[model samples]
Target chain A: MLGYIIRRVVAAILVVIISSMFVFAIFFLGPTNAAAVICNQNGRCTQERQALLEHSLGLDQNVVPAYGEFAKGVFVGRTISTGPGAHYDCSAPCLGISYVTKEEVTELLKDKYPATLSVALVGGVVYLFLGCTLGILAAKWRGTTTDKLLVGSSLIVSSIPYYLVALLAWLFLVNEFNLFPKTGYFPITDDPVKWASGLLLPWLVLGVANSPQYARFGRGSMVETMSEDFIRTASAKGLPRNKVLFKHGLRAAIVPIITIFGLDLAALLAGTVFTEKIFDIDGIGKWGLEAIPVDLPVIAATVLVGAVLVVAANLIVDILYSFLDPRVRLA
Target chain B: MTEVLHAREPQPEALPTSDSDPFLVVENLTVQFPTHDGLVQAVSDLTYCVGLGQTLGIVGESGSGKSVSSMAVLGLHDEKRTRMTGSIRIAGKEVVGASDQAMRRIRGKEAAMIFQDPLTALHPFYTIGAQIVEAYRLHNHVNKKTAKQRAVEMLDLVGIPQPDRRVDDYPHQFSGGCGNAR
Candidate 1:
């Protein structure tokens, strides 16, 4: 177990290394230039100011020194100087400096984490429960009218794009009927009521749209699990029907579910740009898209955050594997 | 006058014990399936009973419906696809056609089950003792320490070595092929 933990920790470090390279590479390979963006934003760059920015920001320095500074900030803490507005500690283990904002990418991400987590987790729970319950009921019926309707509805939901559904929901539900407030976001602490209300509609939109796939996934798994001998055994033991379903069948069926959830979390965090835009949420997805052309720091931070979430999800799945099904070994 | 006086006696219940009634009984239970291919009889009019503290085994290879017939008693088998008709009296209470809430109440306290494979039966991440304690505590309102102590006792009873120390060890720590019975 110690060895496994060590190995996992090393692997995590390697992942961060690779992710950092990707972040650097994206900026390097892309058509957009951070310096040009800065120049454009500045209207015109005076020579002294340009030289100061270039030398200080390491445009004048070689890529090695620049990357060395970045790595040092990322891995080992080191203080570095930046603009006059906010005195960034610029300690070691920093992701990078924001080209546009001239702020530490890590700080920017840490500040906004709650928003992303709130949106993802609450929405995830809503969709997961609704989807699984509906799916099980549909599968129980299998060929009846309720089953047909559920399958057809899920199919329709699956066919429609997430953004389009989100848009329709927002416009009609929030704008037309005025049942919900217009697309807006508030921090949970800043205003709990508004925050909950805001996410409620998004959750509905996201849940209704995403739930079909989950329903199908869950139903298929349930159907497959019901055929397993253990389920039969559980039932035969004169265990209640609920026990047969929840105890044996549910656990057996969840392996695939967790795998899907891990992948889904990553995809949602990345693809949630549309949802964020529609809902007017100032989350990383929306901000990342907007900051792409102007600021590399925000983009880098976004990528890092997304990668962290994906890693966390994987860890959670691994831990859950040993829980959901006893056959799995951590080693 | 004699014909008018004569009365028909009721049929005797299957496996009626001398001292007390049997805990569970199944008689003339039929479980069928209607498919595109044909109507398949999964379990056909099978009868069996298990009294309190009695172990009953239904041994058969795959598709023999040994398991299916038993599932019918619990009403665990699907009602729509597979047709089940007959009596399944559990602890003198009818299991078949029983309400969901009522069946849920009978599951763990009145009866709990372990599967053929112990590896699958135990949840991997949790310690065996923890799982057992949880199972015990779920049905009873005992405190954590009391539950833990009971769990430890159960571990010792199940032949787990060093019950106190091993109580915290996860299921993976156990050697393979124990095949624990619940």
Candidate 2:
């Protein structure tokens, strides 16, 4: 198990490095010239001003050394300058300063992370709990009217585009009904109630929007598990109805669900762009969206962050399988 | 209707609890499944009885109702899907329309079934001992340790060597025959 974990962690790091390189290459190839953009900031860009901007931004250097510096910045801090007179200190794991705001990109990420994590975590909890319960109930009822109703409703919900569902939720629940406080973000440490109230609609919108897919996944898994001979054996063992259904049936069914769950949570944690943008939460998703076309460093940082999260989620899910199914040896 | 079949005659026997009575009785039992096409008669007017000390072997080709009839006795059929009628009594408890609660009480305690294929019958993720322990725990209100001990004991009874050591091994770890014993 220890060896397996070490190998997976190493592999995950390699994956993140490759993805970061891809992000950097894509930004380099992009049509918008970083040097020109910066020089253009001070009115019309003269040839001398563009050259100076290129040298200051390290754009004049070869791509290899520039990438090397970017990589090194993650381990130790690096200084970034827009011009000879304007130098900025970007702390260790420097993602460079924003083109607009002189603040460190990492600092921006730090500020926004709590909101995204809050939404993702709360939304995750709500969806998993609600989806699993509804799926189990539907599986129990099987071909009955209740099962049909649950499955049909889930299908209908999933058929609609997720963005529309989130938009409608915000429009009605927050705007029209005023059932919730205006959707935005507040630090929980400042005021827990306001923080929750502010995010409540986004959480619900994200949770409900994602739940139908989970419900369908859960139902399919459970329905297959229900017919397994062990379930019959469990029933024949005279276990109470609930025990047979939950302990034996659902326990087995939950392994696949956990796989999807880890990935989904990791994706959301990286950012739910639509959910954050629509709800006006100042999160990494919205920040990443706004940074594109102008800020390559922030975009690259978000890409690397997302890749790390996905790889970490994969590792966690693999470890979970060893517990969920004893037959799966870690090696 | 496809084949001219000889329907077995109903055996007149006493209940199994008493000395002269049979342990189990199934009289004129019919099992059918309704599909998109039509009602498929899986078992028609089956009649049989097993005495307390006797073993009944049901032999037939595939698609035969041998497994189906046994499942009916256990009341293990998909209750909402399959159609079962006539009589199936085990220790004087009628299985045909027994309440789910009653069936739950009777199953595994008063009677247990050894399925033909243990590979599909046993849960693959659980160890043989864990599966046995689960079965024991379901019937007995004992804690995990006691149930585990009983599981080892039961495995030993079934002639499995080193029950203590093998108890933690998963189903695939066992040979085909030993897996069946589990």
Candidate 3:
């Protein structure tokens, strides 16, 4: 057990290391050019100004030294920069400062987390339930009109780009029917009801758009699980149809259903830029777009936030397997 | 479905409490499943009885309808694709074709079951204590605190000693002989 745990933990650490390396490489590749471009843009060109920008962002230093300093801030919890906006620390355990904001990445991320979490969470719930229900219905009504209609509808919906669908939903539902808020966020603490209502519109739209995959997967899983001997045993036991379906069949089919949940959350959150933009929602995806160009601190912070969200979602999926089925252990 | 159950030596205590009080009786059970090819009669005219307190060991090769017969007793399959006609009584209550509300009242409370694989059946995202409490609370009207305590008790009962210290540990911590020793 200890060996297994160590191995798994090591693997997770390696994944994080690799991902962080990728982020570092991408950011480093452009820093020098990026500084030159930004510093010189809309101003009288001067070597002194460009030098100032390079020095401020550490573009003047070698990549290894800058990485070392970044590593120190991340590990030692010590601030490297101590200036006006530069007071934002790049201490240990910290990702770093944004080239634009000169603020600590963590602070910027903290402000945006709720929005990302909200969109992803609501979208996940909506898509999962709708997709599973439709899938089960389609499977149950196979060869019937309902089944055919659903399959056709699912195919059509699945083919449409999510961004396009979000726009259409915005045009039809928000603009015409006024069935939902145009878009924007309402903090739960400020007004829970409004926050809930604000989230409802996106959830419905995202759910409708995202449900096709769920329907397909759910139907497949249900069909497979239904054939399992245990399901038959449950039905034969004279357990009512509901118990047979929910308890036995649903339980058995859950692994596959949940397998997609983490990915779905990540995708929905990432996709929310379009959804939020269409609805005028003030979520992180939209925030990312709005903050870019002028606010580098917010950009890196937002990316870190997204990375954290994705990682957390993955962790959640891993733990869910054991509860869904005892057959699986941490190993 | 675990296929490993038959290998387990039958325990004297696992036997039904008595023949008089048949815990479950499945009679003349037939399940017909419609497929693309045609309808397949999975289980035909199957009959069995499990008395209270007895774990009636079911042994069969794949497709022998052993598990199907059990599912029939529980009514845990979809009705559209599968056709079932049978009489199943649990504690003198008829369940074959029973309503969902009725079955919901019985499962986990009147009759609780454990799956073969611990990892899949259990959600790894949550601590084992949470899921156990959920199973306990689904049938009972207990507060979260009480339910969690009961979960710990069950964990200890299930051979997890020092439940207090071990309860907070995630499933990963106890995967192999961590608490399995208890």
> How many Å off is the CA of A308 in candidate 3?
3.8
- Scored by lDDT, the top model is 2
lDDT of 1: 0.70
Candidate 1, residues A78-166, lDDT tens digits: the string is: 66556433345676557776776666777776666666667777777777888898888876677789988998889998999888898
Residue A37, model 2: lDDT of 79
RMSD per model, one decimal: 7.0, 4.0, 10.3
Ranking by lDDT: 2, 1, 3
Q: In angstroms, how far off is B177's CA in candidate 2?
A: 0.9
Can you give the TM-score per candidate against the true fold? 0.72, 0.92, 0.64
Report, for every candidate in turn, its global Cα lDDT versus the true structure.
0.70, 0.84, 0.68
**Residue B107 miss distance in model 3 (angstroms):** 17
Weakest 10 consecutive residues of candidate 1 chain A by summed lDDT: A79-88
Clashes of 2: 2
Interface RMSD, every prediction, one decimal place: 5.0, 1.5, 7.2
Residue-wise C-alpha lDDT for candidate 3, range A177-250, written one tens digit per residue: 99777566778899988888877778888888989999988988988877664554343333556766776677
User: What is the DockQ score, from 0 to 1, of model 2?
Assistant: 0.61
Q: Per-residue CA lDDT of candidate 2, range A1-331, in tens?
A: 9999999999999999999888987886668888887778879889998898778877788777888888888889887785778887776888877766667889899999999999999999899988888888899888889999999999998889989998888898888998888999999999999999999888887778788888888989999999898888888877788888888898889999999999999999999899999999999999999888778888888888899999999999999988888778898
TM-score between model 1 and native: 0.72
Select the stronger candidate by lDDT from 2 and 3. 2
Each candidate structure's count of clashing pairs: 9, 2, 69
Candidate 1, residue B65: lDDT: 94
